[model samples]
Target: MHVLRKAILAAACTAGLAAATTPALAQTTLRAVMHSDLKILDPIWTTAYIVRNHGYMIYDTLLAQDEKGVVQPQMVEKYETAPDNKSYTFTLRDGLLWHDGQPVTSEDCIASIKRWAIKDSLGQKMMTFVDSIAAVDAKTFTIKLKEPTGLVLLGLSKPSSNVPFMMPKRVAETDPNKQIKDFTGSGPFVFARDEWKPGDKTVYVKFDKYKPRPEPPSGLAGGKVAKLDRVEWRAISDAQQALNALSKGEIDFVEQPSHDLLGTLKKDPNVDIVASPMLKAQYVFRPNTLHKPFDNPKIRQALWYAFNQEDFLMATVGDENYIQPCKALFICDTPLATTKGMDALLTSNAKKAQELLKDAGYDGTPVVLMHSTDLKALTNLAPVAKSLMEKAGFKVDMQSMDWQTLVARRAKKDPPDAGGWNAFLTAWVTADVMNPVSTAYVNAACDKASFGWPCDAQLEKLRDDFARETDPAKQKAIAEAVQLRVIEYTPEIPLGEYVQPAAMRKNVKGFVIAPVPVFWNMEITK
Candidate 1:
C-alpha cells in the first residue's frame, strides 16, 4: 500500500508541472465603441472618418506620417529621389502578403494609387504634376513627374481621410465613382466581413501572416503590431449608454464621448479620459452649390453673415474648456491661418444678412438643411443654424436623418425637393483642412470637386499656385488668397473648432496619439 501511494503522489506532481508549462488557448477580444457606425467600408468612396478608420484596419499605406508629421516609409523598404525631383523610385519590403495569401507587388500599389488619385483632393493635385507612374519590376515602382514638385511624397503620405491604402490590383481597378466589392488588404488585421453587421458590430481578427516592422511604433508609422487576437467595434449610438458600458467595464473604449457626460466618465475610477491635441477638429456648414438658393454665392454669403461662431461652439461643445471661436478657414494657430475676408462676413447680424438677401433679389426659398441625429457633437448644429438663418429672413427646411444616411444623400446632384439636399452640417479633422489643396470642401473643381461642387476658376487657380509654390511665405500668401476666395464664394461655413477626447478602461494601453484613431499597437490587460 505504501508503494502504491508513492506512485500516485509522483503522478499528481508530474500533472501539475505539465499544466504550469501549457499556454492559454483562450482568445483575447477588445470591444470598443467608435464615434460612428461604420456603414461604408470603402475608404476611397467617401471622406468619412469612420470609413477611414476602417481602412486603416485592413489596408496598409506605402508611406505614413510619424508623431511629428514627418513622412516615413511604411510598405516601402527604401526609396530614392532624383536630384531634379522629377522622379521617385520605391522598393517594397519583403514578407508582405495580402489577406488572401497573395504577394504584394509594385503593380498592385501602382493601381491603388491611380484609383485613389481619382477621388482624393491631394491625390488630384499630385497627379496634375505626374507624367507617369509605372512599375519597373515585380517589387519596384517609379513615379515620373512632368516637372519638379514636392507633392509626390506628401500626397502619398497623407494621413487623414482618403488615405492611400494599398490593395490588390484587381480590387484597385474598380471604378472610383463606385464602391469596390472586394475587401482584401495587406494590413495588420484581416477584416471579418462575414461577421460585419452594418449598424451593430464590426469584427477584425489579427493577421497571423502579417510581418510587422522591426522599428518601434509611432503615429501611423513604424511597426503596427496587433496585440489582441480579436477586436470588435460595437455600435452604441446613445452616448450615456456607451459611457455606462465603459464605466462598468463592458466596453474597453469610447472614441467620442459627449462633452456633458465627460464628468460622469471622470468619476469612474476604472476609466481613463485621453485628450490628444492632435484630435482637434473644425465644424463646417457645407452648402450644395449646384442648387438654389445656395447656388447663388450671394445667398451663401448671407448665411455666413448671419452665423455666430460662438453660438455654434456653445451649442455643440458646452464645455468652454474644449471649444474655440476660430475665424480662419485654415484652422487658427496654424501656419497660413488668417481672417482676411472674414471680418465683413462673420458679423452675426440678422439685419445685415437680410439686406444682402434683398440686394441679391430676395427670393424666400426654403433652404433644405440636413440634420444628423446620431452624432453627439453635430446634433445641435443644424438646430442653431436653423434658428439663426430663420432670424435672418430665410425659410429653412430642417430635415433629420442618421449620419450615414446623410453621408449618402448628400452625394446626389438632384434638385433639393427631388431627393437632394441644399446644405448639411459636418466636421473635419484639423489636419484635413490645414491647406488649400488638402482641404476637400474648399476644392472648386466643378463636377470633380467634393459634394458641395463649389466651382470657381480663381479659387482653383489659387490652390494650384499654392501647391506649386515651394517658399513658405509665398504659400501663406496663396493660402490667404484661397481663404478670401472661399469667403466670397461661400462654399462652406466654418462654424468653429473644438478638441475631442477618447475614453477607455484603465487596462487599455499603448494607444497611439494621432489625428485619427488607430487600433494597432494597443492591448488590453485583464
Candidate 2:
C-alpha cells in the first residue's frame, strides 16, 4: 500500500497536479434546489452572469475573471488593446475544438456578438454601445466600441454570452427565440439532453467526446478547464429533503440549511459547516410620482416610517445576519451605498408614520401589497404594515404570487396599478447593478417603470451619467447626491438585504453558494 501510494504521489508531482487535479466524481452526486428552474439555457435573454458563469464550466470566454479578480486570458492566445482603448485585437489560439470535434473559431465568437447586438430579437440592453465587431479571420477578431465606457472588459468578461462566448453568427441569428437545445459548443462539455423528471431531478452529463482546452485559446482568458467527466445538477427544493439526502449519503453537499438544524448537523463527525451568510440585497418598490400615492415624494417618505426593516428581515427570512437597515436603493457593499447617512437618521416610528399619512390626507383606502413566492419568508413581513397604515387612516391588503409571475408583473408599466396591486416586495441582485443609479432604475417604484410612479429624474440622469462619465471625483459626487435623493424621494422602501439558503448533507464538497447560481469550478468528491 505504501509503495502504491508513493507511485501515485510521484505521478502527481511529475504532472504538476495534486490528487486534486483529477479527483474522482463523488460517490454521492452534487444536488441542489432552487425556488425556480433557471429555465432559459439561452444566455442572451437575461444578463445572467450566474447562468453564463455556469456556462464557463462548459463554454469559454476571451477574458475570464480569476479567483483573485484579475482578468486573465482564457481563449485569446495574444491580444493588444488599441492606443485609444476603444478597439481590441485578439488572436485566437490554435487547435481548440468543440465537443463535436469542430475547430473553435473567431467566426463562432463574432457570430455570437452580432446576434447579441444588432439582432433585436435578443431583447436585452447590453451591447448597446458597440459600434461593431470585425472577424479578422478564423483566428482573429477586432472589436470596436461606440463609447469609452469603464468596466467594458468587465462587461465583456462577464459570464453571460451577452458579454462573451460568441456563437457562430450563422447559428445564433437564426430565429433568436428558437430553442437550440442540441447544445454544440467549444467547451469541456457538449449539450446533453436536459432531462427533468416531473418531481425528481435534472441532470446534465458530460460529452465523452469533448477535448481538453488548448494550452492557450482565443476568447478564453485562460480559465480553469473542466476537471470532471460529468456534472449533474439535481433540483431538490425542500431544504430538509435535500439535507436528508446529504445526511443519508445520497448526495455530496448542501449549503446553509436552517439555523435550527445547525447544532444537530454539527454533531456529525463527517460534517463540515461554514456559517456563511449569503451576499444579497433585500429592498422594496412602490408607486411613485408616476402613480397616485407615490406621486407625492412625502408619501414615499411616509411609508419609510411605516416599515420596520430591522425586524422585517429577522422575522421574515429568520436571518438576523442581514443587519443592515439600508433604506437606500443600494446595498451597503455597493460603491454607491448610501453615504449621506439618511438611513442612520430615519426611525421606524408608527406614530411618525401615522402623522405623515394624515399629512398626506390619506383616506384609509385599501392599499394592495404585492409579493412573490417568498410567502414562507414573508411571515415576518405582511402583517407589520396593517395597523401602521390603518392608524395612518389607510386600509391595506397583502397580495402574493410566484416569483416568476411577480417579475413578469413588474415589467409592464404600472403593474401594481394595471394589475390592481398597490405595493410590491422584491429584491435587486448585485450584478451589473452595482451602483445607485442602476439600482434605482430597476427597483425604485418612483420610476414610471412601476406604472407612472414618477421616479427621481435627477437620480436617473445621475445613473446615466455615472455609466458614461470618465471622471472619478465627478462620479462620486453624483453617487452621493443620488443616495440622498433615494432617501428623501423614495420610489420604494429599502428593507433588508437577504440571501436564499439551501440544505446540504454535511459531507458535500465544493459548494460555493452565491446569490446567483454558482455551479462552476466546483464538484463533489468523496
Candidate 3:
C-alpha cells in the first residue's frame, strides 16, 4: 500500500497527471458516483450529506463560504451592516432568475430565511437576535435585529445542512418541518426532475441563464461556472464497482472509494485520488435519549467507557496516516478542542462498564444499533459497537438498512421493537462540528434539539454563551465548559477523526476543494 501510494504521489507531482485540455464540447456530460443515494430532496429537512450536495446543485445561497471560511456574496450583489450593527441590508444581484423563469425577489429571500431559520442550528441562533425580516423592495431586504448578533453572516453562509438556500416565496413558504416538493432555484445547475430516479440516478443540467461572477471560483463562493453541460450523480452502492468504472473511464469521478481498495486504485494511472487537508471528519455514536437504556446517563456512560476510539478508527479507516483517535467533541486542531474528560474513552474498560451497568440496574434491554450497509464509511460501526457493548454486559440488536433508511428512521420516536433505533454511528466533517454553535450533535434542547434530543439546560446555556461571546479567550473558556458538560452528559460519543479522499478520472479537471463536494467550475477533457 505504501509503495502504491508513493507511485501515486510521484505521478501527482508531475504534469503528466493533468488532463489534456481540449475545446469545450457541445453536449458534455460528467457521470460520477456520489457518497450515497439521494433519498431525500429537501436539504432543510435533513442533515444528510447527499441532500446537501443535491441542494448545492439546484439552489444558490445568498452568501457563500470561501475556502478560508470567509463569507462572500453569492446571490446577493452586496450587503451593508447598519452603523449600530442592529440591522443588515442586502440587495439581490441582477440576472438571478428562478428555474421557473420568475425573477428572484427579496420577498422570496425573506420567506426562505424565515423557513431556514427554524430548521438550521445556526439559523435558529440567529433568529433569537432578529427582530423582523422585511422586504424593502423587489431586490432589497433588511433584517432588523432586536439585539446585535455576531453570527449573521456565518449562519447565512454556512456551507452545510439547512444552508440558507434561496427559493421562490411560494416554495419557501412551506412549513420548516414539512419537506417542499417544489425544486425551483436560481443556481448554476437545473435539477433534471424527470431524469431523477432516487436510488438509481439523479441528473442535473447546467443553467445557461446563470450569470457567474467575473472573478474565478473560490470554494462555495465567487463565480460558480458550470463548464459541463450535464452532470449525472449515479448511485453506485458498491465502492469497487464504482472504482472499476472510474478506472475504465466509464465514470468521471467517485465521491468515496472503499478504504481497503485505495492501494489498488493508487496503482491505476487513469485515476487521481484527491484530498484537501481542510477536509477532516469525525466518527460519532449518537444515542437516542428519548428511549431506554440510553435515557439513563449512567447506562450511556457505560457504553462510552466500554468502547475504544482507536479500535473504531482502525476498523473504519485502516490507514493510520488518514485516521486519528480524537477525544475532543469540538474536533482537534481547533481552538476549542481539548481532551477534558476523554480519559474514560481512551481505553476500553469492559470490567468498569459492566460494574456501572449492573449498578444502573441493567435489564438487558436490546440496544437497537442502526447498521448502514450501503455507506462504506459507516457499515463497520454497528458490528464494532455491538461487540464492544456486549462485552460490557449489554444486550445488542443490530438493525440492517441503507443510509437513507437510517436517515428517515432515526427521526422516529418509537421504541426499538417499533422500528426505532437506540443508537447509530455516523460521521461529520470537522468544519461542521468544530464549534458549539456549528455542531448539531451537541445540541441539548430536549424536544427542540437535534436527532438525539439529549436536553440539558446547563449545557445549552453554555453553548448559548459561547455563541454570544465575542472575545476569543472567553469563547475558548466557554467551549471548554461545554466540552466538560458533554463529557458528563454523553449526548453523543466522539469516536475519532479521519480524512476521506475522493477519486476522479484524470480527465475531470478543476474540481473545487471545498468542505462540500461541488461539481461547478469542473470540466471534462476529451
TM-score of each: 0.94, 0.73, 0.94
- Each model's lDDT comes to 0.88, 0.53, 0.84
Candidate 2 lDDT, 257-302, residue by residue in tens: 5544555776766666653333354655454254455556676677
Q: Per-residue alpha-carbon lDDT of model 1 for 385-412, expressed as tens digits?
A: 9999999999999999999999899888
lDDT of 1: 0.88
Clash pairs (backbone) in predicted model 3: none
Model 1 scores worst on lDDT over the 10 consecutive residues at: 17-26
Q: Give me candidate 1's TM-score against the actual structure.
A: 0.94
The total of clashing pairs for model 2 equals: 40
Q: Which tens-of-lDDT digit does each residue in 327-352 have in candidate 3?
A: 88888888889888676664789999
Q: Which candidate has the top score in TM-score?
A: 1
